[model samples]
Target chain A: MKVVDIYRAIADSTRRTILDELCEQNDQTLFEICARLTNNHGLGLSRQAVSQHLETLESAGLVKSRKEGRFKFHQIDSTPLDEITARWPADASRSSPDASRTTKRASTETEEQS
Target chain B: MKINWTSIFVTDQQKALDFYTDKLGFVLKHDIDMGGPRWLTVVSSEEPDGVEIVLEPNSHPAVVPFTEALVADGIPMNQFAVDDVEAEYERLSSLGVTFTQEPTTMGPITTAVLDDTVGNLIQLVHQDEGAQG
Candidate 1:
């Protein structure tokens, strides 16, 4: 699977929400996914639209769908995202002393304000 | 907190990748294959670990209208910080980047806008030295 595909899959905000829904509760049917998106997120996308989005996600390896009886269940597969987050080492950004100091100062100020 | 990932929608991922890396001088950070579209990302060469810019495909049904409206209004969807807007603008122009807005100074910032060739207008900006102080 090409890494660009995962980025493409998640590029759409709606698709991201679908992934979030699946992550919250895996093995959701198409109907369940659409209902959850509308009820929870106020997204009233058509079932056909949502299904197409799922196909894109599935093609990118960000989602997996299985058939059980007459229903097709979709599940989130976050391994592709892991590759994205792993691109830059944890300490790469932390190596900047000025940035770290600025963060510390900002957090300290926030703490004092709170 | 630091930003780890940010994305811009592109009509074509391959075209955007070439424009971003060749014209914008960003380095390819990740390019993994899933099945169809690859999970591609790029980072600025100056800040390799700063933030990864994902060239996302605008495949969502609603994306067409949203992007169209933004483009119609000549509004940039994303902005990139540069050391010098004029210099970057000139460099990019030499490399065939079409600028919708020339480098112009406004208060404490200088900005220029360019078409990313993938259905998005990207802004390049530079904060004036000592503007914060």
Candidate 2:
């Protein structure tokens, strides 16, 4: 799968939450994911819907699943997130000049509008 | 204290990435394998270290209905600042990017809206340099 697919997998808030659940407690089943989402986040989603979301995340390489007899377990793999944090240099000063200029202009406009 | 990352929902990740990088001129900032789905992100060439835009998948049960409502209403999921909206519009148009709203000056900012091809409308904006402090 391409890198873009990974981005697509975590874009949705629900999927992110699912990832978070897996992160908090790795190797969970579909029923567990749904339970946590509803109990903790107040997001009442159907088992089928949550299953589909898991499939999307799985296809993107964010979620991994393994079958243990009759139960399927899902887990979160966070290796891909490193790439996102690594994209920029640690120093904020390394940001391009265009960004600063735009920020300055935006602030100036806000002041003028006020 | 600062906004570092933001994302928009897309119907398809690969298609969104191509349009964003090839047509919109963003650079791929990150793409890594996470065992199941890869972690992917992009940044503006002008601000590689600034805010990162994530092309998130709209696969959640709630995303489809919400995104559809936004699309039906012609609302842009997010906005990006450009040096010149008209010039960017022309460049993207040449690349076959479809715009729902052409560049039009609205007070101090000139803006245009375009289809992101991933189930969202994205806006490109320009602020006159001369108006800056």
Candidate 3:
């Protein structure tokens, strides 16, 4: 996952709270999320504040919002990133060998040419 | 600007916390519960206030599988550069940090692989000066 995407999704404090709420129970309307954050988490945030954070998280693919009747519901959408990072193994010597491995041919060639 | 660390969901958040700070000597940054699953972040003492690792709970279907695959493959989610991989490995071993791969040298680089309990394969590597031959 892009650092920017993760950072953008998590930069806001309210959005993190919203994501935690969704984890407990997903696909909740704006009012449900706001009530939980206000009453339970002690965020005491307004509904508009929660919506603004949801908008940013939706843009970053961290959360998805759906329109249901007059309500806009939001849920965590964490499927986009899989195997976000992979790197080649770092090893020099494979076995316990007595002699060092080197490009003998290259050294010999350069010597002969010189 | 400091990187806001990383947030990865784990099946067991407490285990992840112990594996990071207790075993690996990372400083505990945050241990707050937003609402549901507990939230935690650990920062390496080597780079305090730099970049930390957030221990998020693995509840989402996709995140759970993604973490499982990485663990099954024994692929470290990330590698950390260290001044001494062997010494760090030894220290962590004393703290009961089980290493999947022992310290092995490759040319001028040495590395050790260990499990972070959060379904992550973490590597500690030491690169000598001018190893790119």
Candidate 4:
């Protein structure tokens, strides 16, 4: 398994947008991704530039590409981000109603595991 | 002078003819045998006299690799205008056609990319009324 540095992968705004698009709909070809960025986001980037961004995301394990028939499609894999949430205790964050429920749920899950 | 004809390199003319006519609903405009390859062409049923799409053969040494690279990158060699991209996507998909990119809307234009099954990717585009380019 490849170790993913989630921070580095998401450092670029374009890469983050790519992840957001993939999250909205998994499995998009490179051309589709480029079109979305240009049409939806108004980011008129060249295909080669977007391809390099995908490479960086792939290296971080934040993105995966699969060959289907004659074309290739890209997908998002955010599992590498688990390390971030795991390293920092969620309960320690500022008080929010959602956070309180999450803390309680986390404790409940821990109790159940024990 | 008006642009009357455009060519697309096809891996096989017979397959291209069937796919263009039967699958895409294009009308065969010309099919003259040119010894080794045919001077094949098809036009949109909606505008039979608009522009003829020449289904040229990809016999040249550089043509195969060029088309392959473009297909691999999901780039369309040619694009056709349609009234509704989503409808066409649904119709073509039901006919066992493979799409590299599903119908996606951006601003006033919606587009989809599909494999022509003859060594090229073709785009079907639908632009909202009054939308330029």
The number of the candidate with the highest DockQ is: 4
Q: Compared to the true structure, candidate 3 yields what TM-score?
A: 0.50
TM-score of chain A of 3: 0.64
Which candidate wins on lDDT?
4
| Candidate 4, A6-99: lDDT as tens digits | 8987988999999999998789988889988998899999999999999989999899999887788899999988888876657556556686
Q: After superposition, how far is residue A11 of candidate 4 from its true place, in Å?
A: 0.9
Expressed as tens digits, the lDDT of each residue in B1-133 for candidate 4 is 9999999999999999999999999999999988889999999999988899999999999999999888888989789999999999999999999988888888989999999999999999999889987
TM-score of chain B taken alone, every candidate: 0.94, 0.90, 0.86, 0.95
Reference-based lDDT, each prediction: 0.80, 0.76, 0.70, 0.91
The numbered model that scores best in TM-score is 4
Q: Assess each model's interface with DockQ, reporting 2 decimals per model.
A: 0.01, 0.01, 0.01, 0.69
DockQ of 4: 0.69
Residue A46 lDDT, candidate 3, scale 0-100: 66
Docking level for model 4: medium
Mark the regions of model 1 whose C-alpha exceeds 4 Å error after superposition.
A1-114
Candidate 2 ranges beyond 4 A from true positions: A1-114
State the lDDT of candidate 2 residue by residue for B33-131, as single tens digits. Answer: 777555678999988898888777777899988876655434566888888999999989998987755675644667777778888878788886775
* TM-score for chain A as predicted in candidate 1: 0.76
Candidate 1 local Cα displacement, residue B68, angstroms? 1.5
Task: For candidate 3, write residues B20-118 as lDDT tens digits.
Answer: 777877888888978877678888897887787878777777886776655543446677889889899888888787665567564477776777766
Per model, state how many residue pairs clash: 18, 9, 7, 0
Residue pairs clashing in model 3 are: A91-B106, A92-B106, A92-B107, A93-B106, B10-B57, B10-B58, B76-B121
